[model samples]
Target: MFLLMSSNSHHWNLMAVASSSASPQEKYDVFLSFRGADTRNTFTSHLYAALCQKKINAFIDDEELKRGEQISPSLLNAIEQSKISLIIFSEGYASSRWCLEELEKILECKNSYGQIVIPVFYGVYPSDVRNQTGTFGKVFDELEKDRQEMLQRWRTALREAANLSGFDSDVIK
Candidate 1:
């Protein structure tokens, strides 16, 4: 049975269980976040390969979770335990409310647990993330019109995330 834990406390998931046989050095060093439909086979794949080549353990989602499905407690615990979070901000990322919530949680870890957040501006400008321009701006505008409080929370998260050190896709290649 999948256990759903409160957002206020740490949720544990059986799927995320670490092996007792594995040493501490075998643990993943980074948790990668990206919109799979946007750049899964290209940029994200390459980045993951490179990190693996360098011996950096990285975790990335292979399947998209449906909206309204509970995010597994194991996944949340994995994100919290990772030493670094590499967020690949594609154009459509902010449009998904789920991704936005994941981003918010990552930011929470950043502030409270000192997890490092490294944003990768994939096909979008860093300014766009900072200011919520283009598609991102449109999404936020609509959310603000319909849900003021939620929009405020999202805006605060976006602002904090934008301040993190990042690289554009062009620079990466």
Candidate 2:
């Protein structure tokens, strides 16, 4: 199965469904986690369209629903209900509190419910995501000191998600 992000053409497509089998109890085939400003209009949107064409039910949050400081209960619930999660780790992924929160929940679901996690390293190196180096490392300095515990969780999640086998946009196209 391939999640092809054609760099030259700036189009994305899920080249193949990893597995035809799906759990009957699951509400969705996939859950998308991404930084809105980084990929909402381009990569994520095109990927979602590809999933839809394959008749894969996926959950992608609307911009209006992300107006709060905390992640929504429904968004977390969607992660739990999905059979798989495709985390598009872009250049600005770690900078967004929202994206970090979603990453944490996706990993939690993976550990607790056997939900599959496929990390797509888009434009950023997997090592940067794992070690929080380069651009991924900069966001930690700007966060409030009071958020240390939450920040630790985010870092742990990033490291864990980066370790999983998945796609890297830079090498693919």
Candidate 3:
């Protein structure tokens, strides 16, 4: 990124800020977020494998986290330490409260810490996520029956995340 600075002599000077420069070091280069049951065996596994083959530091949760409970401290720390987050939004993604919680934290890191987030709409559409249409909308309706406040957070997070430019699996081929 280049910045323009105004000088005392009424002339503007250009300053270069390279966005690609590597930082000192981080625990992980990328953190994976997805509905494990949906893509764990197919697209996500392939993605994790490819990232490993290229020697990229990626984090894939080793143990499955159950829903509507205290999240592991380590997972929260992982989100803070990673340089990038890859959120794989599948058909049933919003159904998992745990996934919604993770998405909230990921977006928080994005706003407060500048952690990059890349949303992947796998077997779904970005508009569906942003608008909470289709399965996403259905899930929220269920969540609204009880956890209304938490559900609202999830909806806002999805809307913000889906607003970003990301890859569509259907368009890959």
Candidate 4:
């Protein structure tokens, strides 16, 4: 009877784990989000290399993805497969439509998949990202002028992402 109970418990545990796992299975441990123009060569590259050195599977988009009218399918696939998102907020972050789209997708994953999100205020202030002030404010103003329909969505995404617990790059050593 004791042996039978132990075998059943182990089987149940395996079933529970399988049921709770991600549907498509996560491929990368971390997803790096940033303005390539701002940090691709410096902060982002260094961070990616560090993660790699530590044997952490990180997805950092290598090619310039911003030029495309819409974000590539592969990028979206990468985002969906990532377990965590690290958003590196810099001065020009809010200026690009592509970055904004990525932010929206990341937040969506946070809600749907329980994906962890960590924002990094690289050169800009967190308040700026949260409130859309300074550079962020200017960028939004221009975006709103051009694409009025998308303004609220982008703003919400910014506010939502900024509210999460994250690091201020200036404070880091």
The C-alpha stretches of model 3 lying farther than 4 A from their native spots are 1-25
The lowest-lDDT stretch of 10 consecutive residues in candidate 1 is 1-10
TM-score of 3: 0.83
Worst 10 residues of 2 by lDDT: 1-10
Clashing pairs in 4: none
Model 2: per-residue lDDT, tens digit, 10-107? 44545554666656667887899999888999888988888888777888987633545788898888888898899999988887888888998899
Candidate with top TM-score is 2
Candidate with top lDDT is 2
Q: Which candidate order results from sorting by TM-score in descending order?
A: 2, 4, 3, 1
TM-score of 1: 0.77
Cα RMSD to the true fold for all candidates: 10.7, 2.9, 10.2, 10.7
Misplaced by over 4 Å in model 2 are 1-24, 64-68
Write the residue-wise lDDT of candidate 3 on 83-165 in tens digits: 88889999889888878888999999999978889898888889999988988677656765677788788889999999987
Candidate 2 clashes between residue pairs 3 or more apart in a chain or in different chains: none
- Residue 161 C-alpha lDDT in model 3: 98
Q: TM-score: which is higher, 2 or 3? A: 2
Q: How close is candidate 2 to the true structure, as a TM-score?
A: 0.86
